[model samples]
Target: MRIGILGSGNVAKSLSRGFVARGDEVRLGTRTGSKAQLAAWIAEQHLAIAQGTLEGVTGWAEAIVLAMRGMANPETVRAAGEPAFRGKVVIDATNPLVWRADGFPSLGLPEPESAGARLQKDLPGAKVVKAFNTIGHAHMVRPQFANPPTMFICGDDPTAKTWVTELLRDFGWSSIVDVGGIERSRLLESLCVLWITCGMRLENWNIAMRLEQRI
Candidate 1:
């Protein structure tokens, strides 16, 4: 599958390499039309293409990964042209991280409606599946915990969620729990804050989370 990741950050780079190593064609999208780092990455990975303009990447990919900032998602989609994402499965890996005046995190989306919810409404026909938002980029690609970690995914489209769960499995995430529907994206997005806080506050634990089944 051809995956288009819309970001130039650590998450984009990590996922890009992971997908490429797994034999999927990966193209990363950036606002800036620069290819220097992307070129180096392609050479290092032995992959032909690496980065592209937002529209270029979206046009070339069968699936789109909305891996940009949550606040920037609307603009990124707008810039990429909403039609490019129509009827496509978009794997959303963003969080609502607003910088408060008191220098803290705030919610980017208002109550009842989450960032992913807003994204789904805005994109219309796009199948928006929320995944990869709760984990750190360092552990996103081929995470090697003593026990394989769980990846929580939610989307209104069941087929899209299934496809994304398989993709997560390819990334070394064995346990996939479909948290049910797109509205659950709110809890998943907030999980990022809690995960970040714990990782920063605690000294012993690295980036890791296991979803256990007691049944």
Candidate 2:
């Protein structure tokens, strides 16, 4: 699979590496100034190509990963052109988080529902699924947990959800839990707060969430 990731930040780069490791091609998209960094990463990792513009990548990839800043998703859509994402499974790994006056992060989704819902609204032609938002970038793929962590995924399109599940499996996840439709994205997004707060308070960022059950 050819994956195009919008944003050269940590999340995007981390996912790109994971995809490439799983033998899927990757094209990292970024602004002109970020291309050098992207190029360095590509060379260092010896992965696939990198594009300087959003349109460049959107056209090249079979699937898209919207790993950009949550508030900037609309801009990414406009830059990539709405028509390019039609019928493609877009993995949304964003959270609409903003620091509040109390020095804690909070959801700032303009759509007031969830980031997945908001992205679906922004790219009506695209199939958007919420995932990879509950964990840190370093632990995105093949996490070093005591046990396999649970990945909570949700999307309106069942087919899209299945597709993302396959991809996540390839990335070394074996415990993926489908929590429900896109509306449930709110819960996943909010989970980030707990993950972050616990990490900060405990002074540990290497921990992860695992769903345990009795046989």
- Which candidate number has the best TM-score? 2
The segments of candidate 1 whose C-alpha lies over 4 angstroms from its true place after superposition are 44-46, 100-104, 203-205
- Candidate with maximal lDDT: 2
Q: What is the C-alpha lDDT profile of model 2 across 77-104, one tens digit per residue?
A: 8888989999999999998888888777
Name the lDDT of candidate 1: 0.84
Error of 2 at 133 (Å): 0.3
Query: lDDT tens digits, residues 93-135, model 1?
Result: 9997887775546567877768788889888889999999888
Model 2 residue 191 lDDT score = 89
Residue clash pairs of candidate 1: none
- Enumerate clash totals for all models, in the order shown: 0, 0
The whole-model lDDT of each prediction reads: 0.84, 0.86
